[model samples]
Every structure is written in C-alpha cells, then in structure tokens.
Target: MESVRTTTTRPAAWLMLGIVLVALNLRPSMAAVGPLLSAIRSDIPLSFSLASLLTMLPVTAMGLAMFFGLGISRRLGERRTVLLSLLVIGLASLSRLFLDSAPPLIASAVLAGIGIALIQALMPALIKSHFPDHVALCMGLYVTSIMGGAALAASLAPLVLLHGGSWREGLALWSALALFAAMAWQMQGAGSSPVAAAKAGRESFFSNARAWWLALFFGLGTASYTCVLAWLAPYCMEQGFSEQHAGLVLGFLTAMEVVAGLAVPAIANRSRDRRGVLGGLLVLIIAGFCGLILSPHHLGLLWPCLLGLGIGGLFPMSLIVSLDHLDDPQRAGGLTAFVQGIGYLIAGLSPLLAGFIRDRSGSFEGAWWSLTAVMALMLLMVLRFDPKHYARHIR
Candidate 1:
C-alpha cells in the first residue's frame, strides 16, 4: 500500500464530532429504557422478569456482537462499520414506535444492542488511530458524551411519554439522534483517502494477550456502567419514590457521571503510572456502595454522585489503559473489541441478576452486594495491571 499522511486538523475536527455523536447514541437506547421499564411492563402486562430481560437482551447482544467486531471493522472499515451501526441503531430505535407486541420490542432491543456493540468495541481503536496525541482528552470527551446522552435520555424519555402521548413516541425520539449521528459519520467518511482505507483492511488486531487485557478491563468497567444505568432508576422507585422523581434522580446520577467521566481519567493520566489512580477509584466505588446501602434516601444526591464518579473513572481509565498498553493502533482496535466484547458480556448480566435477586429476595440489597463484589474484583485486576510493560510482552 502507498503511504498516506496522518489526518489533518480539518478532518480530525470532523472525526471528533463523529466520535461524540456516535458515543452519544450508544447509551441512550439502553439507559433510557431502564427508566421506563416498569411502566412498559405494567402497560404490557408482562412479568417483572420479562421487563428485566428486555433490558438485559440488548447488553447481551452488545457483548455477543463485540466478539466479532474487530473482524467486522476490518472488513467494513471502522468508519463504515460505525456509520452502518448508527443506521441500524436508528432503524432499530425507530422500530419501537410501531411495537404492538413483546417480540417486536425485544427485537428492537437486540438490534440496538448489536449496533451499540459495534460502535463501543471499535471506538477505542478509532480514537487511537485518529487522535493518538489527544487520546486522554478524547477519551474524556467521549465518555462525558456517553453519560450526557444517558442522563438526557433517562430524564427526557419519561417526560416525552407524559407530554408526547405514548411510550413508543418516547422511545423513538432517540432514533432521531442516532440518525443525526449516522449523517455525521457519512460526512466524515468522505475525507478518507484510498490508502487509508486500504491500510485499514490490511491491519489486523485480534490475536494477542494485550487484546484480551483491554477487552477484560473494558468489559469489567462497562459491566459496572450497565448495572448502574439498568437498575438505578428502578431501585429508586422501589425505595418509595414516584416514577418521575426516580427518573430525575437517575438522570442526575448520569449527569454527575458526565462530569467525573470527563475529568477523572484526564487527571489520572497526569501521573506516570495509573495504579494509584485505579486504587483510588476502587475506594470511591466502595464508598459509593456504602452510601447506597446506609443512607440512600437521606444522602440521595451524594450517593449516586459518588457511584457516578467511581464509574466515570473506571470506564475511561480502562479505555486509556487499553491505548497505553498497545503499541500498534490496529492492536488497540483488536484489544478494544476484545475488552468490550467481554466487558459487555459481564455488563449484560448485571441487570438480569439484579432483577432476579430483587424478585427472589424482595429487596435491592443483593444487587448492591453483587456490585461491591465486582468492584473488589475489578480493583484487583486494575492493581495487577502494569500498563507500561504489559503490552510489549503480550505478543
């Protein structure tokens, strides 16, 4: 392949916009649904377990789809895959507008899951390739957008339902955002050179331990994110709050995550090694859990803020670590897919297990217990990770 220069500032700006737009769409479909799951379940006359499954289905599909994303990204070109994914997500999200039965609703979930998985798994690699110098900033920006999207969707979906008439209209509103993202991506794609496109196909990234580590860390971190977004709203309502208030609280938590998610990792990256940063985040996570259990109603704002902060740090740190650990951009992409694939798999189960525990125990305490234990395990993994040397030896 002929050589090609790195992307220029004009193209980079467009890529950045595309990244933010794509990231924004990733979480809304998943997070928005949780805030309304109970209402949807009641309206459809389905079991609580079924409601939980609807939430779980997308996450599971996300993980499952990530398992093959590197190859898919290679085949389609990362830009094309992302653009296509956005289109699929938009269509799937649009499908909810016509849903008259449980099966179609579930199909929407699955379609959104697949689209999200493709984007999530490939985003790290895309960032590394397009913004190698500004990865830390880019990571922060992308994650903040993710939390912002979740917060907006969480609060707005129910409001839309109340104001716009039905749950279908509420859910379908996000599809417009997804469509906007798809358009942005297509615009960015027009600037790519033939050499860049060819090189993308030649680059391979799915066969190393570094890839596995990235995938694992991403998986673990996202598992926490998924758990929080999926169950927090329901937990709030279950604790005697009204649905509107519950949705607002969840929105607030997600908004707090946007701030932390943007700031924490950027701060952590200032250090030579990030183990200390990781350790600190784990401590905060532990504190967040304690807050959740002991002073939930009283502390309210503080509790979710702490959890959001912890999650924000964890998610972006994992992404930053993946980039830091990989020498090649393609390897970064491969590792991203691996980590997200596994991370999403783990994430997919959090809501389901939480729901099952809640159903059986008649309380949300079990969910907290599960989160605490996962946080502990994640702490160990982050502590053991030696990002500086790990990737070179991973082969």
Candidate 2:
C-alpha cells in the first residue's frame, strides 16, 4: 500500500465541496425519521419499544461497524470506501420509500448505519490528509454540515407529512441528497490511499484507563443527544404542541447545535487547554436538562437552545481532545475509532432506555432526569481527562 501525502501545493475546492456534501447526508435519514415517528407509528401500529428500535438499530449498527471501518478503508482505499458508503446510504434511504412495516424499516436503518459508520470513521483522516493546513476549518465545516442536515430534516419532515405525503415519502426523500453527494464525491476524482497500520507491540487502547474515561465521557454526552433527537418532538406533542410545531422546536435545537459546533471548536482551538471550556459547557448542559425537566412546555425555546449549545460544543471538543492526546496521527486515529465505537454503542442504548422509562412512568420527565444524571457523570469524567496526565502515554 502506498502512503498518501498530507501536504498539497494548492487548495482543492472540489474536494472540500465533496466533503461537505457527504457530511450533509450523514444525519438526515435518522433525524427525519424521528420527527415523523408519530405518523409512522400510526401507520405501522408499533409499540413504544419497537418504535425506539428505529433509532437504536442504526446507532448500534454504527457502533459495531466502526470496528470494521479501517479494514474496509485499507482494502478499498479511502476514496472508493467513501464513495461506496455514499451509495449504500443512498440505496438504503431509497428503500425507506417502500418499507411499510417495522421489520423492513429497521433493516433499512441498519444498512444506512453501516454506511454512516464507515464514512464517519474514515472522514477525519481524509480531511487531515487532504487539507492538512486547514484541518480545523474543514472539520468545523464538516461538523456544522452534519448538524445542519439534521436540523433541515427535522424541520422538513413534519411539513412533508402536512403537505399530503406519508411518513415513507418523508423519510425517502433524503435519498436524493445522498445520491447528490455520491455524484459530487465522484466528480472530485479523489484517489485511494493506504491506511496506516498499528505498531506491532503497542498496547491496545482497550486496556488504557484514560481511553475508557474519554469513551465514557463521549458516550454519556452522546446519550443526551440521541435521547433528545429520538424523543424531544414526541415529548413536545404530548405537552400540547402540534406535530409541525414540535418539529420546529426540534429543528431549532439542532440549529443551535450547528452554531455551537462551528463556534466552540474555533474558540477552544485558541486556548492552551480545554478544561475550562469543557467545564463551562457541561454546566450549560446541566442547566438545559434541568430546564426541560422542570418546565419543558413553558420554557420551550430556552431549554432546547441551552441543550443544543452545550451538546454541540461537547461533541467536537471530545474528539479534538482525544486527538490532542497523541502526536502520532495514526495512534490518535486508532484511539478515536475506539472511543467512538464504544461511545456510540453506549449512546445507542439511551433512546431505548428512555422509551422504556416513558412507557413505565407515562412521562418523559424520568428520561430527562436520566440524561441530567448522565451529564453529571460526564462532568466528573472530564476532571480526570486533564491532558497533562496522559503525556506519558503519547507514542
């Protein structure tokens, strides 16, 4: 395998565009379904437990698929792997158009999850290799696009249903976006590159204490995020908001995430260490969780905005912190894959558990309280994540 060069003599606008487009497709399939879930349940007659699986299955698949991403990238090359992932996303999303029952819908989610996992696992490396000089800027753009995609889908799904489309059509329309990304990626003509293999005698991240801490922090943070994504709109509807209005509130929350996703990284990048920043964000998350539990209906806009700001900052910062732990890009990448793999697996269970809580208690308050506890745990976890402590572990 040939090593891919990281430095380039000139800027590649096409490559950046392709990256943004691919990022845009990453969340719509999952996000859109959540807003329209009520309509879907009405059509398909699914129980709460099964309905929760709609989100859980894809997330769980993504978690599991992360372990395979590097191998797939090595075999197919990064460019081809990404292109194939896009094709899979497009086809899987298209399948939703005809899927009328829970089983097939869950199957489509699984397929989309595999594609998403591969692309997400591979993309940061692609960005680092192709846009070394502008890695932060490109990454901020990519992350913002992902949140923006979710916001757009959440905002649009309710409208799609209101305008005479079924839940199937609402979910399936995202395939067009995926197909567009596939075409755009192909036009870049990006060639494949060899993935760096792990050193022969290095200790596995699985056994490292700091690694698990980071993964736990990431998982807890994502649990809060996935829980809201899967349940917020339904919670709002139960509180007397219309489906379309609930969707808009959910959209607003994700839009705030887009804002923080772009801003927080740039702000954190200038600081010598992220401890203060991470601490402050966690405070905001705790406040948001409290607001939701105490008075969700009354403080509609405030709580979501606060939650979005905190989560948006936390997600990217966690990844950046992990990368900062190791100077070696390959080692950092490996730790990143490990963290996300475990983190996503843990995060995947959040919605399922939240749904069960909702079923048993007949309210989402318990779920929100559960998220608050998770965030509190995340706060404690970060105290142990001081970068100086991990200096000895650097390769």
Candidate 3:
C-alpha cells in the first residue's frame, strides 16, 4: 500500500488555521439548541419526549453518517467532502431561520448532524497524515476548537433569547460561523487524495477486538457528554437557576472543557501510554457526576468544573489513542470512523434515556447516577487500552 505523500512546502500554518476554523463550526448547530430548548418548546408546543428527540435525532444521524464518511471521501476527495460538509451545515443552520415547528427543526438538525459526522470522521486522519510528527498537539487544537464552539454556542444562545430575540434567530445566527468556515476552507485550495482509502480492503474493522473496545469506550464517553449537553441546563433550571444562568453554567462547563481539551493531549503526548492520565480524568468525572447527583445546587460551580475538565480531556485522548493504534492513516481513519459511528449511535440514546429517566423520576438524579455508572465503566475500559495491545492490530 502507498503512504499518503506530502509536499515539503505544504502550508502547515494555513492548514492548521483552516482546521481550527472548520472544527469551530462542528458543534454549535447542536449545542446551541440545548440551552434554548425551553424557549423552542414553548413556541412550538412540544412534549418533553419530542423535545428530547430534537437532540437525539441529530446525534443518531451523526452516528449513522459515520459509516458513509469513507465512501463519501473516496468519491469526493477529503477537501471537497469538508467543503460540502460546511455548505450543508450552513444551509441546514439557515433553515432554522424560517422553521417554527418540530418537524422542520428536527430535519435541519439532522442535516447539520450529517455534515458534522463527515467532517469529524475525516479530521483525525487528516491530522495524522499532515502533522505526522505532531498528531497529539494537532488533535488537541482540533478538539479544543470543537469545545470552544460548543462553549460559545451554549453561552450565547440564551443571551440571544434574553435580549428578546426569537429562538429561530438564535438558532440561525450560527449559520454565519459555518459560512465563514466554508470561505476559509475554500481559500486553502484543493483537497488531498483519500489517504486511508487503500487500507479499507486489508482489515475488517468489525473483526478487530481493539476496534470494538475503542468504539465502546468512545460511546460511553460520548453518552456522558451528550447527557450533559442535553440536560445540564434544564437540570440547573429545575434547581432554580434562571434560563440564562443555566446556559451560562453549561457554557462554563464547556469552557473548562476547552481548557482541558487543549492541555490534556499536550501533557499526554509526553508519555508513551495514556492510561494514567485517562484514569485520573475518569476519577474527576465520577466525582463530578456524584456531586451533581447528590447535591447539585450546593456546589454548583464545582461539579461542572470537574465534569468539564475530565470529559474535555477524555474526548481528544480517545481519538488520539485510536489514531495511535495504527501507523497507516487510511487504516486509522477507518478505525476512527468505526469508533465514532458506533460510539455516537450509543451516545444518541443518552438524551432520550435521560429524558425518560427525568420524566419517570420527576428529577434528573437518575440521569446523573446513570452517567456516574458510565464514568466508572469508562475507567475500567481505559485500563485495557494499553498501547502495546493496539500495536499488534496495526497492519
């Protein structure tokens, strides 16, 4: 198999900047909706079950779309795929401007999800191929930009409502970011040939034990994240925080995530194995989930900080570990997509499950405890993620 060739004079700086810009658009289309859920529900007259579906459908789309990412990239090339993703995201986001009800809104969210799935599934491979010597650092920046977008949207969505703007406007505003990213990406010039395409025929991703483990690990971690993103604001609001304040709290959590997302990968890069760092972060998430369950209102600030720092670090580390499992960029891309595809499908259930738990229990305690259990599972799973085990799977 041929390796991905790179030009010695490739514009690394501009490429990194483009990656950051594209990454920044990945999460806002979904993250922004959570904080504004109440307002949207009030206007659209949606049930809790239906509202939960608003979050679930997109994530499900993301998960399902992952399976097709490789095929799409093969047909369109990576650069064109990304550009198409940005345009899809922009159009989907703008669709919300005219949408006033549930079906259309959900459709827009699903479209945005498809775009997000394609870009995210391909990015790890792009980083591995382009920044071979600095995969961890590049993944760190990419993940940080993703978290930063989530934070910005989560923080600002409620503010848009607080200023008397409609939910449609609040949701539509993020399209501008997508548009800007599209423009920046276009300026970066032509796409590279699909680097990971050749390896697709060598190994069946489903047959690899390590792939299954990584997918499960990724799914469990994402479930925790999805629950938090979908419910934390409403949970806080139930505890007497105003909508704006709850959004800010969720925003604060993602902001801490951005900080941890950038720092953890950089620190973990110094080590050959990341189990120790992964272990410590899982502990923090456990503590945070426990706090949120037991006394959410008492130490409100601390719980999210812990959650943010822990999960923030875990997100990139999970992807980085998967990328490190194989030397071939194409193989790594296939593995990463499989991980995200299965993981996100699992994660798509979280918001709905949390909503079910919330509706049944009349509180989010069950939801929080469920996440705590997931964190424990994540800790146990990471123990098996020794890099040596994955080294054997590399073709």
Candidate 4:
C-alpha cells in the first residue's frame, strides 16, 4: 500500500466515492436473507431456528472478526485488506448461486460476515485519518450507504424472485454489487500504503464499568435491529402480506433508517447532552414493537417506520456517545470498535432468540413484546448518560 498525495486534487473526491461504494457492500448479503427466508426454507427444509443461523452466524463472525481485525490489517495492510474483503464478499455472494443445502448457505453467511467485518474494522480509522476535516461527512455517508445497501437488497430480492429467479438467484444477485464496489475501491486505493494500526488495547478499558455499560447499551440497541433484519419480512408474511409487500416493508423500513441515520445525528449535534434525544428514539422503538404486536396488519407501515427511525438513529448515536468518552480519534475509534465487537456478539443471538420464541408461541408476538421491554429498559438507562461524567468514567 502507498500513501495518498495531499498535493493531488483529485484523490479526495475519488477516495470519498470509494468509501461510499465499499460501505454499500457491507450488509446486502445478510439483509437479503430475511425477505427470502421462507422461500429458501420451502425448498431447503429448514426450521425457523436453523434458518435464523443464516443471519446469526454471520453476525457472530463479524463480532469475532473485530477482535482480530488489526492483525489482518497489519499483515495485509489496510488498503489490501479492504480489497480482499470485497473479493471475499463477492465470492461468498456468488457461491449462493449453487447452494443446495443449508450447510454451505450458512458457511457463506459466515464468510461474507468475516469479509464485511474486516472492512468495517478498518474503515472508521481510515476515514478519520484521511478525511480529517470531513470525518463527520464521510462517516455519515458511510453509515447511510450501509443501510441503503440493505434497503436495495431487501426491496429487490423479492422482485428478483417474482421475475422468475429462485431464492438462490435473489441471494446471489448481490455479487454484482460487491463486484462494483471492489472495482471502485481498487481504483481509489491505488498507491495507498498501509498505515500503522492504532493501539486500541494499550489503554485497556476492558476493566472499566462504563465501557461495559456502553457495550451493553449498544448491544441491546443492535439486538433490536438484527432481529428485525432477520425476521421482519417473514413476520410480515405471517400477518398475511405477500412476499413482495413483505420485502417492500423491510425495504421501506431500512430506507427510513437511512433518513434517520443522517437526520438524528444532525439534530443531536445541536446539544452536548444526548440523553433527551436518546430517550425519544427509545420511545419510537417501543412504540414500533408495540404496534407490531398489536396492530401489525392495520397500521403496518407505521411500525416499521417508527422502528427504523429509532434503531437507525440509535445505531450511530450509540457510537457517537461512546466516541465522546475519549478525546483522541484513535482511542475513540478503538472504544467504538470494542463496543461493537461485544455488541455484535450479543446481537448475533437475537434473531435466533426471536426464532425460538416464534417456534414456541406460534407467532412473532412474544419476540416483539420482549424487544419492547428491552426498549423500555433502554429508556431507563438513557438517564444515566450524563455528559459531565464522560471523563471520570474513562479516567
């Protein structure tokens, strides 16, 4: 990897485009699964719990991969790491084209998850490093692109199936997007050398109670998201919606997420204390879950809209709150990575848990109720995040 030349005027624009493209590849592989889960199971014969692993396994891989993300970057270099990850993602998506049984399908999920994690684990610091003055803008774009990719996959996968493609074809279609992202990334990453990996473990916050709190907060917030991403389409189908409409619901939900991801942070930015905003987001989530449990078929769109805006806003806000704990970008990025790493591990099980509840209760209502309670718990937790204690907790 070579370094970018500051004197070159064209590099910045190209790099930003590359970052956006790379971010777009992160979620489609996993996101496409829920909308097509029933179809896949109809052919492949998986129980609800087993099918949940398609999402859970990859999420678990993402969590585990973060612990070793630095080692991969150190050995392969950041630029190559991103390219390699994109290639891995593309091949994993491509492999779904021939998947006959559940084993290989789950395996690809893990493989793609690992690939997504490698890129994600590197990107934050990369953005902070190269786009110093524009870190916020770049990060915003990167986060939005991730949700945007999920929206595309969710909305389009069913359309693909409707137009004579099998569920396998729908899953495999993301390979094309991955290919484009890889090509764009390679062009921008040319001559970009490997930078030194940040020393995140040096100032170890593993023992800090506050770090654990942040991790738990982020984890619960993420659990809500993973559960929905893995089950929303199927749940919609249960409520009597067709596959296309179910897909559209998830797609629209994620689109709302993209909007909130950008909008919520901008609004939150106006205040140093984020608790009020956090509480509002939690209320939206609780309301969304309640709507799903009580009135899914009647006011269906509103529930997803509420959930998406809440969870989407919560995702970035959790990281922002964590990042606020440290002054240094490297250290802050490290903490955010740590929170997400643990958070993913917690999150990976949520879809599986929801699946189990659905199996036992004969409906997804129990799971939604549980998530509502979690949101309520979060509302209580939000009160403790006083801005004045930021330094004391870390110190």
Candidate 5:
C-alpha cells in the first residue's frame, strides 16, 4: 500500500551551505578528544579504558539512535529536529568546560553523539529529496565536511593548549561552531520543510541475512575508523611524537580522509563493480597497520598518510556499496540505516577494545594486529559484493 507522502524541497545554494556546515559539526566533539586524551587523563584521572568511553559512548548512542531517529524527525519534522539536535550538541559541548569528572564528561559525549545521530539520520533523505539532481555531489560534500571538521578539531585543539589554554577550553570551543551551524540551519529551515512520509512496511530488518552481512561489513570497517579516530593521536604520542605533532598526524590523517572521500566516489562512479577498488584500499590499510606495528619512529609520517588514504576511501565506499544494493532511495535509506545501526554498535566497541588491550598488554600492538586481521577479512568480503547479487539478494 503506497500511501500519499509529501516532502518539501528547494535547490537554493544556502541549503547546500546549510548541509556542509552542519556536516562539519558532526565530528569535532568526538574528534577533538583523541589528541588531548593524554592531557584529559593528566588532570581527570581517566584511565585509558575509561577514556575510551569518550568515543565509545557517543558512537554507541549514534548506533542505537539510528533505529529510531527517522521516526523522531518525522514527528518533529527535519528542520526543527535539526535545530534541536544542534542545540543539544552545542550545549553538550559547552558543558565540557564545567565538567570535573569522568562520568559527566562521558555523559556529555553521549549527548553530543545523540545530537550527531539525529542530524545524520535525516541528512540523506534531506539531501536526496531536495537536491535530487545533485545527490551524489551533495553526499560527497556532506561526507567530506565531516572529515574536514575532524581535521580542524584534531589540528586545532593541540595548538590551543600549546599556546597556554586549558584542554577543557580546547574541547569546549567546538560549541561555538555548533552554534554557528544552528543559526545557519535556522535561516535555511523554512526552505527545507517537513518530509511527507508514508508508513513503511513492518518487515523486520533482522530477518534479512544479506542486511546482516552488509551491517557487519560496515560495522567492521567502522571499527577500524573509530579505533583510529579515538586512538591515533595517543598511539603517535606513544611513538614519542610531541603532543602537537601527534595531533597534527591525526589531523593530517583525517584531512587525507576528506580528500579520499571526494575522490573515491568519483573514481568508483566510473565502475559499477567496486571490488577491485575496495581491494586496493584494503591493501593500503593493511600496509599502514604493518608500518605502525613494526616501525614506530622511522618514516612515521608515511604510515598515517597511507592509513588515511585507505580508511578514508573505505568509509564512504561502504555506504556507497550499501546504497548499491538497492536503487530505491527509500529502500536504500532503510538498508543503510539498518547497516549503520548495527555497524556502529559494533564499531563503538573498538576503542574500548583497544583501550582494554592497552591496559592488558601495556601497548597498542595487540589492537593494531587485530585491526589488520579484520581489514584482511574485509578484503575477502569485497569479492562477495559483486553487483550481480544486489537485485537477487534485495527486495
């Protein structure tokens, strides 16, 4: 039963700007913390294991939220929902400045993650519904801005402290960015109105084995991403890089992701079968992990460069692959939402897993090796993503 569905859209440039700026807000609250973990721990008595919650809590919230986020947007409408999410994020980020202990800090991170999840849930439909002709371009822009925000926060936070500011300030200043985005969203809110949605079928996503595979694939790939995002700076610090330099490496790595996010989709657009490209990216990831494990000091910069190129490409590609599984935007959105839901729940554990490994082994080597193996597993999984299976396996 296809019921009437009404959705409002306008193709103005400000809406595009709104999308990019909002995308920028999604990552900084989480990304800024990794480099400063050493500092945060110094003052707050936060162990590596407990500190993992900074990343894990938010990501876990995001994963859990994806399942219900679309419904929230429908009831509240996307515009107001986006505004509310932004304020939640801004207030959460602002709260970090006053927080004195681990629990409050982590709670704020979860709040920020919920905010990110709410906006993330609505963004694809908003972009696709409004910028139908430019869905690909807008998506690429959205993904890249996410990376760009990480890059900015990672690079800037250390610089702030290096110049004599407190780490709290470094973490909390991102609230200002969220505020700016909130204002921009308010201005563009009228243009991108409520989505007229019809009730989707009650079919359980859990019943689908193919959906599980895609979810696992996306989950494992994200594990690698969130692990690095949470641990890379601290790992580099363990490598004896200066605090500033370690943050820079993480920043550069995320910047490379921004570059790859844009380029990978364009390159993959020329070929329907993305397995070959996926394989190549996995090889880079494996090699980068190898370098990080074997030689911590020599050619240190090269490792993040390679890892950035590989992981960056893989993230967007994972979503693209899931999207490839179905042509209908509505169906693809549902499939991708299901994938991200389970995938992020799986991804959220990685940082905690890495932190636990560190607590046990006294080094991050075990986590790196585990991640390397997982990437290799992903390499093998690519062969299964053959385009021929898409239609047969879906709908």
Candidate 6:
C-alpha cells in the first residue's frame, strides 16, 4: 500500500471560489420545483399522490442512480462523470420548458435527479482531492453554495414564474446555472485524468467501515432535510398560510441553513472526534422537529428556522465526515455515492408518506411527528459512530 498526492498549485482562494461556484448549481433544479408545486399541481390536474410523486421520483431516482454510480465513476472518472451529469441536468432542466403534462415533467425531474446524483456523489472527492488541507473550510463553502442555491431557487422561483408568466420559465432558470457550472469546471482543470482517480478511489474506499457509518449519517441526515424541503410548503398551506407566504417561509428556512452549513462542519472538524459534535446536531434537529410538530403555527418562523439551521449543519457535517473518516480522498466519491444512494431512497419516501399520512389522518401533524421519529433513529445511529476514524472493520 502507498500514499500519493497529486501535484497541483493555485491560490487557495480561487480553488474555494471555483468549488463553491460548481456547488451552487448542484441543487437548484431540484429545489425550484418544490416551491412551485401548488401552481404545477393546479395547472396539471395531478392527484395528490401524483403531485408528490413528481417531487419524490427525482429524489428516488437520485438515490437509485447512486447505487450504481460508483461503478459508473470507476469507468468514467470523477471529473468527466460530474461534467457529464451537469450536461444531462442542464439539458433536462431546459426541457422542462416545454413540458405541460405530468409524464414529461416527471421524466425531466428524473433526468435532473440522475445528474444531481452524479454531481453529489463526486463533489466531496473533488473537494478532498483539490483542497486537502482546507477540507472543513472548503466543505463549509461548498455546503454554503448548496444551501444558497436552494435558498435562491426557493425564494426567487415564484418571482421568476410571476415575471415570466409561467412556471416553465422559473423551472428552466436552473439550466443557466448548470451551464455556468459546466463551463467553470471545464476551464479549471480540463486535462485532469479520471481513470486514475477511479482506480485510486476503489483501493481506498472498499476497506473502510467508518466510510459506511458516515454514509449512513449522510443518508439519514439528508433524508430528514429532504423530507422538510419536499413538504414545507404544503404543510404551511395546510396551516392556512398563503402560497406566497409559505414560499417565503420555506425560503427563509433554507436561508437559515447557511448558518449551520458553514459553521457546524468547521466546529465539528476542530475536534479530533466528532461524536460529541454529532450528538449536539442530533439534539438540535430533535428540538427543531419538536418545534415543527408542537409549535409550528404558533412560533411562526421559529420552528422552520431552527430546523433549517440544524439541517444546514447536518448536510455539511455529513459531507465533511465522509472526507475526514477516509484516509484517501479518492474513497470520498464512492462512499458519497453509497450514502446518497441509500439516503435518497429513504428520503424519497418522505414526501410520499407525508402525503399518505395527510390523506389517511386528514392532517399534516402526523407527518411532522413521523419525521421526529426518524430524527430519533438517526441520533442513535450517530452515537455508535466514532467520528474521528473509520469503523476498525466491518462487523
């Protein structure tokens, strides 16, 4: 066994900026659809479950694609895989401009999901490879960009749709972001080798247990966040808030996430071991979920605000943990794919189940309570994980 560090030289500032720029476009296509669900549902004649499916299918697809994405990355290389995914996402997002029916819309969403899966799976590895010393700082910025994109899309999608006179234009706006990401990635390191990267990843990732725990944390944490992302608007509506107000609340919640996204990973990384930090985050999420279930209406922005912050921290911490636990940066990619593949499948069920619970119980409260239960399970899992290192061996 040997350790290799690739030769690369650039100012730290520019590398961070470029990574964030690429990260910014990663989730806009997915985030934009949630805020506009009501309008899409109203215009398209979708059943409640079907409308939720439009949202869940892409997330589900992202997860499913991730299951085999590592093998794909092994063959294609991480950089090319990411670039290819961005191109596919860009094209799919743009195609939504012409879709008036559910099937076409669903297809476009699935395409975007596939692209997102590729990008999400590869990013931590890219960050580790490119910014070995600044994993925490760079991950903070990367997560910031991710939540920033989601917040921007959530806040602005309504305005875009209003001004463009259609939801199609709003949804298609992500295509431009995707194009920019593709160009930035191309210009930065066009000659980087992917086959070497993939080979390197395989040797590093397959022998680790900590990688699996981190992946579980990433998956479960992300699942919780996506559950909220997918349902926040509808929950608001059910509570009697106007669509515009609900959208804004959701936007504000996402904006609050930036605080956690940047701060938690930095804080967690400071300690050699992250279990205490992980425990703290689980507590915050518990508190936030409780807020949503017990006081969402009364506290107004308080519950979502707290949940958003907790979620923000959770996302970056999970990603940073993946990098930290692995001795090799290359392993970060495959580990990421596995985590996302499993996590998104868990998350993909959230919106659908929330809808089912809503229909079954005639209320969204039951859904919130259910989310609280998931968070509790996630907390217990994090407890068994020794965050400073990988599990000694797979038991």
Question: What is the TM-score of each predicted model, taking all chains together?
Answer: 0.91, 0.95, 0.96, 0.95, 0.94, 0.90
* Candidate 6, 79-175: lDDT as tens digits: 5676888899889989988998999998998888888877776667767777788788778888888899889888888787666557888889788
Q: Best candidate, TM-score-wise?
A: 3
Error of 2 at 8 (Å): 1.5
Q: Which residue segments of model 6 deviate by more than 4 Å? A: 1-7, 70-78, 200-213, 387-391
Most accurate candidate by lDDT: 3
In model 1, the worst 10-residue window by lDDT is 190-199
How good is model 4 by TM-score? Answer: 0.95
For candidate 5, lDDT tens digit of each residue in 98-163?
989999999999999999988877676666656555555667778888989999999999999999
Instruction: For residues 1-395, write the lDDT of model 3, one tens digit per residue.
Output: 22343536557888899999999998898888878988888889876667788778889999999888877877777778899999999999899989867899989989999999999878887788788899999999999999999999999999999998988888889989988998888887536664346455234688877788888898899888888988899888888889899999999999999999989999999986999999999999999999888888797899999999998999999898888888887778788999999999999999998898887889888888888988887887887878777777655
- For candidate 6, give the lDDT of residue 115: 80
Once fitted onto the true fold, the runs of candidate 2 whose alpha carbons sit more than 4 angstroms away are 1-10, 195-203
- For all predictions, the C-alpha RMSD in Å is 2.7, 2.0, 2.0, 2.0, 2.7, 3.2
- Model 3 is weakest, by summed lDDT over 10 consecutive residues, at 1-10
At residue 186, give the lDDT of candidate 1.
80
Model 1 misplacement above 4 A: 1-5, 190-214
> 294-342 in candidate 4: lDDT tens per residue?
8887777899999999988898788778877876656676677778788
lDDT of candidate model 6 versus the reference:
0.74
TM-score, model 1 to reference: 0.91
- Between the candidate structures 1 and 6, which one is better when assessed by TM-score? 1
Model 2: per-residue Cα lDDT over 123-172, one tens digit each? 76666656655555667778888888889999998899999998888898
Residue 344 miss distance in model 1 (angstroms): 1.1
Q: What are the Cα lDDT values of the candidates?
A: 0.77, 0.81, 0.86, 0.85, 0.85, 0.74
In candidate 1 the C-alpha lDDT for residue 366 amounts to 81
Clashing pairs in model 1, backbone N/Cα/C closer than 3 A: 215-338, 215-339, 219-343
Cα distance off (Å), candidate 2, residue 11: 2.2
Error of 4 at 288 (Å): 0.8
Off by over 4 Å in 5: 1-9, 190-196, 200-203
